[model samples]
Target: MSPVDSNALNELYKAHLAEQQRRTEHALQRGGFDALLIASGIEKFAFLDDRPYVFQPNPHFKLWVPLIRHPDSWLVIRPGHKPRLVYVQPEDYWHVPPEAPSGFWVDHFELIVVRKPEEALPYLQVPGTLAIVGEADAALGDIVPNNPPEVLNPLHYARAAKTGYELLRLREASALGATAHLASQRAFGEGRSESAIHNAYLDACGFAERDLPYGNIVALNEHAAVLHYQYQDQQAPAQSLSLLVDAGAHSCGYASDITRTTGNGDASFQALIDAMEAAQLRLVDRVRAGVDYRDIHLASHRETAGVLRQLGIVKMDEEAMLAQGVTSTFLPHGIGHLLGLQVHDIGGFMAGEDGGTIAKPDGHPYLRLTRVLQPGMVVTIEPGLYFIPMLLDKLRATPAAANVDWALVKHLSAFGGVRIEDDVACRETGAPENLTRDAFAALI
Candidate 1:
């Protein structure tokens, strides 16, 4: 990874902070609140166990400052006033304490350091109606977070549009994820076990398993059929047919999600992978301001149907296949989703900033995003075609089964499936920026 230009980042951070303040002030006013309080969230212990699960800071808090590890912290924001951060740097012999707040963002906030979580209460006694934002667990005594929908709706809706600072971090995250992807691809080529390939990915990115934006899908062969493939086998398959790696990296608080598939000397399956790559790129090109995301998802179905037909798997025209629901059997998941602080970011289906929903297209229940594309929004264009036995078996009982070449399906099922994903950013004019592609291209 390249060293970040701190001077440039500092300037971006300033602008980003300004925008956040503007958004929060608007939300507070709209919700009839004098101030907004955001908690960094507290750690929780596992059921019947002393060990705590990895703490994930509130996205609301992260939007203001890039403090992901700190817990029991609070942010106070009121219109026309500078934001206040009640930072906690607990004194403990069992764990290393959090460092004092520093960096370009610190100066913008009124810093209030406290040794214990309760100590920060004195600073939070601001006048007027305060809307607290955070999980109920993070509430300090009677000051539980209300999490009013009126305030959150607009804020969540507005988060879809990325600030310049957020885009920079997202790009860096893509580069870091791409580096790990290259290493994992090599590990797969060398016939490494699933666990080993996952390790190579982490080693290349210098990220612990917990640091990842989400769990890595290090699937090999038939395992790829499972969309969110979770487990990693320690033993290498006797003969690896294919490997599908869906992994990502985080920069600051933003995340980059990318996926790639490789075939092991299978000429026919390799062709399918190539075809899917082409189809995915076409879908990526379709992303821009004003286009409905559901249309892109529907387009993906058409593309996947075309691949099945061209490859002799489905013996029917694309339209007939789609009408018979043949395409759904192969591509079960959505074409893509919004991407940012969360992997499947919030507000993908939101009607507007005031809060309503844009329903997913009929029969495409798995689609995650249904909003119209807009400039500054980032989304994933992931189109996949899989041959899962469960779905295929159901298809066999239907009349549409006659249109499918079962023989070809049997042969390709060994390779599991093919999915190519890239994170794309919508723009106001011209073409949308392919963040994943550009990051990988830079390596060459």
Candidate 2:
């Protein structure tokens, strides 16, 4: 069972509401609005007469209420006042009407249920005075005026720093996801096919495909070299060399992303995996409040180069290899990214609390995070080393090619790659807490 206490869920809910109110009030003042209306969003439909896609409550709306139902529910917020929920309960046999949630958060909001979403407009502030968020099409026509980026950007920026409640959900997510990783890892060792391993992971976590934070990446052997290896080959190789599983789980509305690599009795390949894991941990230790995330990413490259030298994969010193961009050939991706409601959470590159953005450094377009580390922020520290044939072929044609041992690369490439990812939480002091580590420890 998850370590998250049931009573704590209520406490988390209360804390979440406080944060939402704080963000909403600040946004309202900055955007020059007397009130804010956040919609739960409407269901989307596919081509022609296709059944509507499963409803995903607007992140903004879910931040305020746990209700995930469709039918265009809404939230009304004003400074120093109790918020209101314009609940929608459709009266139809085609689908079951959503019952009002009964929880610690429900009492905080003055609930008003209506048969149609438009009926709740009378309970809101004047159209022009209220700023609307969520689905633009779900708006009650002129009953609620829309607030553009100017109003939304502030809230988006504030979400980067999580509250105590959000952290708890994140911890639960990490702990749960670690269990799934353990199951998948064992399946690989048992010579299970990639598809079978993927199924084992989901079954262990009790989550459906759509319920996942993102699609699972279950790759075996050479297939691991593909950055976003999407295929889950039905057949397992006669001799399994390695396995890479990048998967995650959700708790409440938060997410935990984790990746692990395992070897199949290949001494050299196992050594590389151990080296990558150790280097990843050392990099994770660098996560602390006030540290620049980009610096951590660069540090990872330098460290990865050192590992390559130790394994005789790179001919030059770590510094020389980094300077020659040889490290990029092995570890091509950004060290990691922010983790939260969205897997690649928003505001990663936001310039400030209100708006603007910071561009990724040149030649590092895949880097997803750019902000300086701060307390209450959670991010993934994933460092990878791969012997990709395409990248290796390109490097083979370059002058820096001499820095690599082609024979070793050819032998190691068959084992694919190694990636060690952990969700880390920044602290006001000391080393950033390793959620993945704690999650795994909890299992024992």
Candidate 3:
């Protein structure tokens, strides 16, 4: 991986902080509050065990600063005032404490450090109505998070558009994730087990499993048919026909979600993979300002139906196949979703800052995003074609069964599925930027 220039990053962070401050001030005024408090959430212990589960910082808090691993910290923001960060540096031998906050961002914030969580409460006392943003466990004394929708609605809606600093971080994350993907592809070609390929991905990215943005989907052969495939087998399949790796990496707090499918010397399956790539690229090209995301998803279904006809898997025309719900059987999930801060980011279904919703198209309940594309908004375009036994069996019982070629379906089921995903950024004009492709191209 290429080294990130710290000097450039620091400058970008300064601008990012300014934008965050401006947004917060507007949100506070809209919510009729004088102050807003965001907490770095506390860690929770496993049931009947002393070991704590992984600590996830609140997205609301991390948006202002890059303090991802630190918990029990707080950010106090008041309109027309410099934000205050109550850094908690507990003195304990049981675990290593967080180092004192020091970075380009630290200078912009009014820094306050204490030995315990409760010690910082006095400093948080500000005049007028103060709105807290965090889980109930993060509350201290009488102070608790109300999570006012009036304030959060606008903030969540605005987060869909990435800042310049956010775009840079997301690009770096894509490059890192692409590097890991290349390593995993090499491992798969060498006929390694699913667990081994997963390990290679982790090693190449230099991130522990717990540090990843989401659980890695390292599936082999028939396992690829399952979306969000979880477990990793220690032993390689007797005959490896295909491999589907849906995984990602993070830069700072931003995330990149990517997926790739590879076939092992299977000519027929390779053709299907090629076809899916073409269809996915077509969908990615449709991402730009003013385009509705739901149309892209519906287009993906049409493309998948076309692939089926081209492959002789279905004899019916595209229109008939779509009307009969044949395409839904092969492609069960949505084409893609908004990618950033969280893998499936918030506000995809929100109508506007005033708190309304844009309902999903009828019969497409799993679709994650329904808003129109806008400049600086990053999303994933993933179109898939799978042959799951359950779905196929259900289709067999329907009147549309006569249209499908069951023999061809059974043959292709050994290879499982094909999914090509890329993270794209909508632009002001012309074509949208393909971040995943650019990251992979850099590897050359």
List per-prediction Cα lDDT, in the order shown: 0.92, 0.86, 0.92
Q: How accurate is candidate 3 locally (lDDT)?
A: 0.92
Better of 2 and 3 by TM-score: 3
Score every model by TM-score.
Answer: 0.98, 0.94, 0.98
Off by over 4 Å in 2: 1-8, 69-71, 91-100, 118-120, 124-128, 143-147
Clash pairs, model 3 backbone:
none
Looking at model 1, how many pairs of residues clash? Answer: 0
Which digits, one per residue and each the tens of the lDDT, describe model 2 over residues 1-444? 455565787777787788888888888888888888888888889889769877787787877776655558888888878888888887889878887567656787888888987787787654446777866777676654365677788888888888888888789899889999999999998999999999999999999887887889999999999989988999988988899999999887789999999998888898898888889989999999999999999999988988998898887878788777888889889998888888998889999866777888677778999999999999999999998888898888889888788888888999889998999999999989899999998887
Error of 2 at 432 (Å): 1.0
Higher TM-score: candidate 1 or 2? Answer: 1
Better of 1 and 3 by TM-score: 1
Kindly list the per-residue Cα lDDT of model 1 for residues 1-444, writing each as its tens digit. 466688888889999988988988898889899999999999899999999899899999998889889999999998888899999999999988899888878988999999999998888889999899998888887678999989999999999999999999899999999999999999998999999999999999999998999999999999999999999999999998899999999988799999999999788898899899999999999998999999999999999889998888988989999899999999999998899999999999999878999999989898999999999999999999898999999999999898788988898898889889999999999799999999999997
In candidate 1, position 9 carries an lDDT of: 87
The residue-by-residue lDDT of candidate 3 on 131-161, one tens digit each, is: 8999999998877999999999999999999
